[model samples]
Target: MSRKLPIVLGILFCLITNHSISQVIKEVEGLYYNTTGDLYTGTYTEFYESGNKRIEMNLVEGKRNGKITLYFENEKIQEVRSYSDGLMDGTWITWNDNSVKIAEATYKRNKKHGKWYIWDDNGVKRYEMEYSEGEKVGTWYIWDENGNLLKERKF
Candidate 1:
């Protein structure tokens, strides 16, 4: 039937397209890398044994050069960070297994050079510290979950 021919052709087309798209995914024993290595440079995507995405990052000249994202076994995002010339240069955030944010910090050239804040599992501020050139050079504050200031120390 003429109508049946069209339907079969459409289905064939879809199958072929999907197959080609899947083939584009670079495959490894336990990871995937980008095709056209020149364009992607040294970027890679690592996977868990169950085939879940574990980490994705960009690299240039064999060093981390851009944004990186890591995922937990449950496929929840565990952390996100940005790098410049292989050094952490911007905001970095880490999450617990429950997908709750545990800590956030800023860095410059791999050194903790700015504010860092950490929270407990209950979403309570645990401590806040300031850093200068990788040294704790400013005020550090600790607080209870109930917002009670426990202590403050200055360097």
Candidate 2:
């Protein structure tokens, strides 16, 4: 074989292998500031090592704004929360790894402001709580997995 032919073949092999390896080595990829205390506008996303989506959120001048969604490594929806101008607002919902609704709560300016519901990992309702601007104000309930009324208390 010609000496020039061997050198060209070696270059081609290195380029192909390096490209594929770089794709996996990139663990964290997103559109954000490169320095601390810097906020980039628009949506930014993160992913798990397995390439599954981890979190996706929006930012306006580096403050949390709009809706944020999180997911499980298995690609299931984990939580969906809303925000306004860097504060938690509107309804927030969460689910289990099995894709079952686990809990839900409301917030206004980052404080709990309304009813909250919770369920066990087996998807059974376990609690119903009320909150007023981060403070409990009314009746709260608890239940067993068999749908039995376990307890009730007023705050």
Candidate 3:
């Protein structure tokens, strides 16, 4: 046998015996789960009935605990969210069907806690707002597609 035979056999064994580690464990109502680790921490993905990816998110202790991505039926990304210990705690972004960014915001424990921006499908800035713990604060600006300020307000 070649010197590399043992290594190759070991890899083959792992591939055959551990395939379940990456296999989807469950599917219910169009959702699929793939988990590993002692705590079963891994990614869980859901598919739309149209066969497009609906959502893909990480799970820690079976709770949403990491980056989450959502997709439209056309396979375009619709939104991206981050979670820590099952609560939203980081950047969140959304895009329109045309792939133009529609909104971007930051969250701390599922609450809007930072600057938020909105744009139209034509990629024109529409609004900008500030928030603290989900409450609107500071100044906000609204503009038209023609780059004209439609309104401005201070909270």
State which candidate has the highest lDDT.
2
lDDT string, candidate 1, 1-155, tens digits: 99899999998996685555444446444234445543234556666766677888876654677889999988999999988876888899999998888899999998988999999987788999999889997889999989799999999
Q: Residue-wise lDDT of candidate 3 within 1-155, one digit each (tens)?
A: 69899999998886664454336555433333445323446776666655467888887765678789999998899999999887889999999999999899999998999999998888888999999999999999999999799999999
Model 3 regions more than 4 Å off? 1-40
Global local distance difference test of model 1: 0.80
**Distance from true position, residue 118, model 2, in Å?**
0.4
Off by over 4 Å in 1: 1-42
Model 2 misplacement above 4 A: 1-38
Per-candidate Cα lDDT values, in order, are 0.80, 0.81, 0.81
Q: Which pairs in model 3 have colliding backbones? A: none
**Ranking of all predicted structures according to TM-score, beginning with the best and ending with the worst:** 2, 3, 1
Q: How many residue pairs clash in each candidate?
A: 0, 0, 0
Total clashes in model 3, counting residue pairs 3 or more apart in sequence or in different chains = 0
Q: Give a tens-digit lDDT track for model 2, residues 111-143.
A: 999999999999899999999989998999999
